[model samples]
Target: MPPVGRRERNKQEKLDRITAAAQELFAERGVDEVTTQEIADKADIGAGTLFLYAKSKGELLLLVQNSGYAEALVEGRSAAERIPDVLDAVLAIVRPVVECNRKQVDNGRTYLREIVFGDPAEPHHRDALALTVQTEEAIADVLRRDERFSADDAAALAHIVSAIMFLSMAATINRTNPINDVVQEIRDQVRALLRG
Candidate 1:
C-alpha cells in the first residue's frame, strides 16, 4: 500500500478527535443537550471545521453511534456462531446490540431516528444504513443454519428480526426499561416468529 500523505493523516486525526469528543459528550448528556459548538470545543477544532466534517449535530451523532453499533454487531455475530438453538443464537446476536444501544437511552433513540430519516446521500448516514444491512445479513446467516429455512426465507426472517430489534430499542416505553427486559421482549417476538 502507498504511504498516507500528511493532509490525509491530519484529516483522519481531526475526525478521530471529533468522534471521540462527540461520543463522550453524548454519553455524558444526550444528543439534544450537546451542541455542535461544545463538540468542536471539546475536539479542539473550530466550529466551522467541525461542520465541514459533519454538517449537523444529527450527522455527528450518526458518526459516533454508528461505530458503537458496528462493534456491537461484530460481538453479537461472534456470540451467535457458538449457540446451537436458532432462536437462542439469534438472541445471542441481539443481546450485545441492545446493551450497546441502551448504554445511553436517549442517544440510542436519536441514533435510530437519524438512521431512518437522515439524508441517505450524507456519508455518515449511508454508513449507518449499511450497518443495518450488515446486521440483517448477520442474522440471516444464523437463520440459514436451520435446515428449514431457504436462503430467501432466512433473508426475509432476518429483516423482520432486525425490525423487531430496532423497534424494541426505539420504542418510547422501552426508553427507560432495563436492557435485559428489552432483550427478553425481542426474544419473545423472535421466538414466536420462528416457531410460527
Candidate 2:
C-alpha cells in the first residue's frame, strides 16, 4: 500500500545490480578468474562504481558472501540474546549454513572451494581475520548466554563449530560422503566437544 522510499529503493537497487553482475562473472569464470572490470561490464557500470559498493575483489567476494547465504548464517547469530547458550548461538549460524550447503550442494561446494583458495586478503588481509573474529564473537555471544560454558570452553567450542562446518562443507564438496551423513557426524562431534 505504501510507496517505497526513493533513497532506500536506490540503495538496494544498486546493491542488487552489483551483486547480479558479480554473480554472473563469478559463475562464468570462477571467483579468482573474474575481474572487477568484468563485473562492472556485466552490471553495465563503470569500474570505479564497483568501489562504491565494495573496496576490492575480496571485499566484493565477502560482500557477495554477506549478501547471499551469509545472511542465513548471520541471522541466527543475530537472534541470540545474552541469556542463551553461546553454543546454541554458534549452532544457529552453523545449522542454517549447513542446510544451505545441503540445498545448493554444487554451488555451495564451489563457493567453499573458492573462499578457501581465493584471495580473501587481497586488499586488507585483516578483512579475512575480521570475518573470522566476527563469526567467533557471534558464537561467543551464544555460548556466553548460557553461563554454563566457561569462557575458555566457550571460545574453544565456537572454534570447534567453525572448524567442523568448514570440514563438513569441504567434505560435501569432496562428495565422498553425502552431506546429510557428514552433517550428522559434524553434529555428533560438535555435541561431544560442547559437552566436554
Candidate 3:
C-alpha cells in the first residue's frame, strides 16, 4: 500500500474526531436529541466542515456506526467459530450486531431504517448496504465452516438469515420488551428454516 499523505492523514484524523464525538454524544443523548452543530463543536471542527463529512444527522449516525458494525461482524464470526451447532453459530454471528443496536438504540433504529430502505445513490447508504453484504458473506463463511450447507446454499441461507435478523431486530426496537426475546424468536424461526 502506498504511504498515506499528510493531507489524507489530517482528513482522517478529523473524521475520527467527528465520529468519536458523535458516537459518544449519541450514546448518551440519543440521536434525535443531538445536533450536528453539537457534534462539530465536540469534534473541534467548524459546523460546515462537519457537513462536509456527513451531509445530515442520519449520515453522521451512519459514519459513527459503520466501523462498529464492521468490528461486530468480525467479532461475531470469531465467536460463532467456537460454537458447535450451526443454528447457534448463526445466532452468534448476529449477536454483536444486536449488541451494537442496543448501544444506541434510538440512533440504531434510525440507522437501520435508513440503511435498509435508503437510496443506493447516496454514498453513506451505499456503504452501509455494502457492509451488510459483507456481513452476509461472513455468516456464509460460518455456515461453510460448519459443513451444514454447500457454498451456494450457504450464500442463499446467509441472505435469508440476514433478512430475518434485521426484521426481528427492527420489530424489537423501542417496543418496551426485552431484546433477548426477539433474538430467541429469530433463533427459533431460523432453526425452523434450516430444518426444511
Candidate 4:
C-alpha cells in the first residue's frame, strides 16, 4: 500500500478527534442535550471545521454510534458461531447488539431515528445503513447453519430478524425496559418466527 500523505493523515486525525469528542459528550448527556459547539470545543477544532466533518449533531451521533454497533456485531457473530441451535445462534448474535444500543438509551434510539429519517447522501448515515446490512448478513450466516433453510430462506429470515431487533430496540415501550427484557422480547418474536 502507498504511504498516506500529510493532508490525509491530518484529515483522519481531525475526524478521530471529532468522533471521540462526540462519543464522550453523547454518552455523558444524550444527543439532544449536547451542542455542536460543545463537540467542536472538546475536539479542539473550530466550529466551522467540525461542520466540515459532520453537518449536524445527528451525523455526529451516527458516526459515534456506528463504531460501537460494528464492534457489537462482530462480537455477536463470534458468539453465534459457537451455538448449534438456530434460534440460540441468532439470539447470540442479537444480545451484544442490544447491549450496545442500550448503553445510552436515548442516543441509541436517536441513532435509529437517524438511520430511518436522515439523508442517505450523508456519509455517516450511509455507514450506519451499511452496518445494518452487515448485521443481516451475519444473522443469515447463522441461519444457514440449519439444514432446513436454503441460502435465500436464510437471507429473507435474517432480514425479518433484523427488523424485529431494530423495532424492539426503537420501540417507545422498550425504551424504559432493561436490555435483558428487550432482548428477551426479541427472542420470543424470533423463536415464533422460526417455529412458523
Model 3's alpha-carbon lDDT is: 0.85
The digit string of per-residue lDDT tens for model 2 on 21-50 reads: 876666566567788998888787888877
What's the C-alpha lDDT at position 95 in model 3?
84
lDDT (Cα atoms) of all candidates against the true structure: 0.94, 0.67, 0.85, 0.95
Which residue pairs clash in candidate 1?
none
Candidate 2 structure, TM-score to reference? 0.63
TM-score of each: 0.98, 0.63, 0.89, 0.97
Model 4 lDDT vs. the true structure?
Answer: 0.95
Q: Rank the candidates by TM-score, best first.
A: 1, 4, 3, 2
TM-score between model 3 and native: 0.89
Q: Give the best candidate by TM-score.
A: 1
What residue runs in model 3 are displaced by over 4 Å at the alpha carbon?
Answer: 1-3, 145-148, 172-174
Error of 3 at 64 (Å): 0.7
Best by the lDDT measure: 4
Clashes of 4: 0
As a whole number from 0 to 100, the lDDT of residue 55 in candidate 3 is 85
lDDT of 1 by residue, 6-71 (tens): 999999999999999999999898899999999999999999999999999999999998888899
- Candidate 2: residue 12 Cα off by (Å): 9.4
Worst 10 residues of 3 by lDDT: 170-179
